[model samples]
Target: MKSKKIKIMILVIFIVLLFLSIGFYIHKHHQDISTDNAIIDGKTVVLSPKVQGYIKKINVEDNQKISAGDVIMEIDTTDYQVKVDHAQAALLTAKAAISAAQNNAIKAGITAPANVEVSKKKIDAAQATWEKAYADKQRMQMLINSGACSQEQFDQAVATEGSAKATLEQMQAELDASNAAPVIIAASQDTVEQLKAEEKQAKSDLAEAENNLQNTKIIAPMDGRITKRSVEVGSYVEPGTQLCSLVGLDLWITANFKENQLEGMHPGNKVDISVDAFPNLKLTGIVDSFQAGTGSYFSLFPAENATGNFVKTVQRLPVKITFDPLSPEDALLLGPGMSVIPTVHLNKGDV
Candidate 1:
């Protein structure tokens, strides 16, 4: 009878302990939200050429690590260099034309005023000569009428007066032409301005040519690894041709958790991550944000639930988790698309 009682008491204690363990596990599971649908994500850049050319050199191989501003490829510059030279020659020609026009303008400016002054002086001299000749003709006419001068002498004096008057009229016309100096100078200035405009156009062309030439060399945009290389040496490529892709070092995690598990989940919640690739390695991060919509909503073909066969389904929302400072070794091992499992601590006070 004693042996039977001892066995029953031991059974009772074991059952009680089993119940307590179950209750504790349930409480811990509720506090921590975990998801296996997670993967590493990061920025990716597609590299393409802006100008068309044959690939002359390639500085990087597939998966080669690089830094920002590193030259990754070179295009044959024969055609682009020729274009630059042609543009430079055109610019020089334009400058020479501008110089010639400016000199002509300067000459016109000085000659205009001087010509007007000289013409005015010539007109004054011709007028004075005409007046003197008129006086001589009048004196000769008087003398001839009083029979002191001969008719031939009077005729000579009259001809002299007529010649002087004609000279005076010619000088007046010359003065009028000289007064047009301003107009001539203005026309010359206009020519200079036109040449200047041409020079500006030539300068713009030269800049464009230089830019094309510079674009022949492809440079890395950021620190990344070369990936998906598609070009080889001597390969002909045009603008918008995809040469390669660069995968950036910046990374984050995308964890898709069920809607029911998001009750206490929020930004700043602590997370413990485990990468499938390195099973033994562990990582820590924080809940950064929640995606606005479920993953299915952003899919190419979303389901239309309003149709005939309507059935409610639980949705999974993507949560962004950012890593804490990673060690160099960890950084090397971690990469985009790697599978990971993350557990979020809903209580902020919990580690």
Candidate 2:
């Protein structure tokens, strides 16, 4: 009886352990989150010229992958080169004017002292002549009144006195002009500054022209693949015109999840992803974050909840998830608009 009891007891213990293991497995699977079949994709970047010009050369082919800082196309740079030359000439002219203005200022400063001295000497000479002429006129007027001199002689003396007075006034004006010349020359300093400003503006124009010329050569902004080649040699492309598009290799998934299913979803959750195009391949990723609001909130026109009649709706929020880099041996290639399915394992870690 003891041997039979021992065998039954061992069987019962094994059954209890098996039930516990099955329950644990069910609980673990429940903690996981999953989604429907979606697409694997990347970001699309548009490649366009900064300035408008004719397409001179196209070095990249359609669907060709290129690295960052690679030259893709070139525009006709003749017009930009002419603009640079014009700016340079204007700058040189302004510089020459500045030099001439400086010389004029120096010469004006040098002549000031000599001009003042000459004016003073002229004023002294005019004063002496006026005194002599005034005395002679008074003597002649007295003689004419006493009948000792003729009226014609008195008239000649008066005319001499008037001429001397005019000469003295003219000398005084010369002295004033000499004193004011320095201030007049000082005002010309502004002209020098104006020329300098013009030169600076010309230099800036030259730099802008050089920048536009350099922009004629279209270069790759990032590591990407070129597509939709709408440009060719001799094509007259203008600014804002679509030449082609470059799709970046670095990509992340945007999963739209229903509002009700986002209770435990958070960043740092481990995600298992599979691409619809490649059924056998699997990718690992992490939940980056969630969008601030629903995708509909940023539509062409959002709903106005303040209206008298309103209807409640379920919204889908986009969740951003990043995938790890694929191994080189797999040779798996992905591009924009590819579909993917992402299953998030929420209970894998502390997150």
Tens-digit lDDT string for candidate 2 (249-327): 7888888878877766789888998888788888899999999999899889987889879888888888888887767
As a TM-score, model 2 comes out at 0.79
Per-residue lDDT of 65 in model 2: 84
The local lDDT score (0 to 100) that residue 177 gets in candidate 2 is 92
TM-score of each: 0.79, 0.79
* Alpha-carbon shift of residue 8 in model 1 (angstroms): 12
Model 2 has an lDDT value of 0.84
Estimate, for each residue in 193-312, the C-alpha lDDT of model 1 and write its tens digit.
999999999999999999999999999999988889999999999999999999998889999999988987889999999999999999999999999999999999997999889999
Candidate 1, residue 120: the lDDT equals 95
Which candidate should be chosen as best, given lDDT against the real structure?
1
Lowest lDDT 10-residue stretch of candidate 2: 328-337
Summing lDDT over every window of 10 consecutive residues in candidate 1, give the lowest-scoring window.
Answer: 342-351
